[model samples]
Target: MNHRRVGRREVLAGLAGGGVAALAGCLGVGGSDTSPLADHPVAEGLADQPTQGPAVGDATATVVAFEDPSCVRCAAFHRDTVPRLRSELVDPGTVSYVLRPYPVVFEWGEAATRALWATYERDAAAFWGLLDHYFTDQDAFSSGNVLDLTEAWLTAETSVDAAAVREAAAADGFPAPVQRNLDVGEAADVTGTPTVFLFRDGEYRTSASGSVSYEFVTSALEL
Candidate 1:
């Protein structure tokens, strides 16, 4: 139960600029010095968050991913690398992957919330399936059509009772968690979406922002 709960202010701060991270690092908050990321809390019932808790590997290594749905880089990471990670590592239980939604911009925040609700109301498979659709069509939503595109995307995804997902998204049920995620990201000195953290053997390592290759991530894994 030693999980770090991220706050929205931190998330927005990181999205706003890199100054916050510099300050956090100077303050020793983002360093390997006793920060929550360093401690690597055990997240329970994480299925409601984004994806499930890592599949629980024997090597005691865990992957924590922070992503904003509207981020093209995040989409690229999903497309370019995550699938391989899933097949080669996550699915095989070599690593436990925990995803935290770090919704920075408003459009992405709404989508992230909808995705959370989709996972809660539908199922994990449905939620990820919808995520695949989102990444595939990341360019479809201009600022003028965020909600419209999101609604259409939800409607097209299976496993979700689209009506209910949209209802929850409109109502904004996942705001608190999303906000918390933002806060944690900022505190950890994350400058962008797709900021990843790998925890193994009581140590935490950070990844370069955006679509990092599987080789780099795997090489960092302590296993």
Candidate 2:
């Protein structure tokens, strides 16, 4: 329920301080050719686009969220807003929700994102669990131990194959879709975590940066 808003200046400073910007040019271009959402029910009726991420629900309205797994503000949005959003909007099929992994905060953010996609590829339920775990226990991980911790969590808490997930996460390059998510973020001029876009009837609508409320989303959707 707590919201910690991070500004663009602070995000840019973090990127510079962590040397993430330098690594941008070196981002890997090879990995699995399969779409992470290939088997996902939410992929139905969705366009085939490089910028597409995992989706849920079927509706005329769509909500695309770009988030960093290790971002506190993102965590706040997940914790404070997601449950209500699901109950009031997604579960009712009023809107479709998509999650774009934008790892802009921590050094291990990319690793976590890879693991997330791997989990979703393996099992949607486990993927949601891993997403909640990363946000809820962000402090319990670091660059050195993000993969290990994720492996341990998947092994202990989910039915997903931990070893395969680890292998995917430890792959040489970012997964194709994850890399496309980065490209999407760049094109959208995303400045920080939890940047969300709302659309109606497949047309672009408004967007919000940082933590947002259920009311804000509904208002954007004109629901």
Maximum-lDDT candidate: 2
TM-score of each: 0.72, 0.76
> lDDT for every model?
0.60, 0.69
Best by TM-score: 2
Task: lDDT for model 1, please.
Answer: 0.60
lDDT tens digits, residues 63-151, model 1?
Answer: 77877666666787888889888888777766777777766544555654555555555677776776676668877755566556666
Please give the range of 10 consecutive residues that has the lowest summed lDDT in model 2.
25-34
Give candidate 2's root-mean-square deviation (CA, Å): 10.1
Clashes of each: 12, 0
Q: In model 1, which runs have C-alpha deviations exceeding 4 angstroms?
A: 1-48, 52-59, 106-109
Candidate 2 local lDDT, residue 120 = 83
- Model 1 poorest 10 in a row by lDDT: 22-31
Per-candidate RMSD vs. true structure? 5.7, 10.1
- Once fitted onto the true fold, the runs of candidate 2 whose alpha carbons sit more than 4 angstroms away are 1-10, 14-57
| Residues 1-223 of candidate 2: C-alpha lDDT, one tens digit per residue | 1112223356768566984432232211112222334242223333432122224334757777778888777888889888898887777777777787777777677688889988888787888889999999988988889889999999999989999998888776566666666665665566677777777665555667665778877876688
**TM-score of the candidate numbered 2?**
0.76
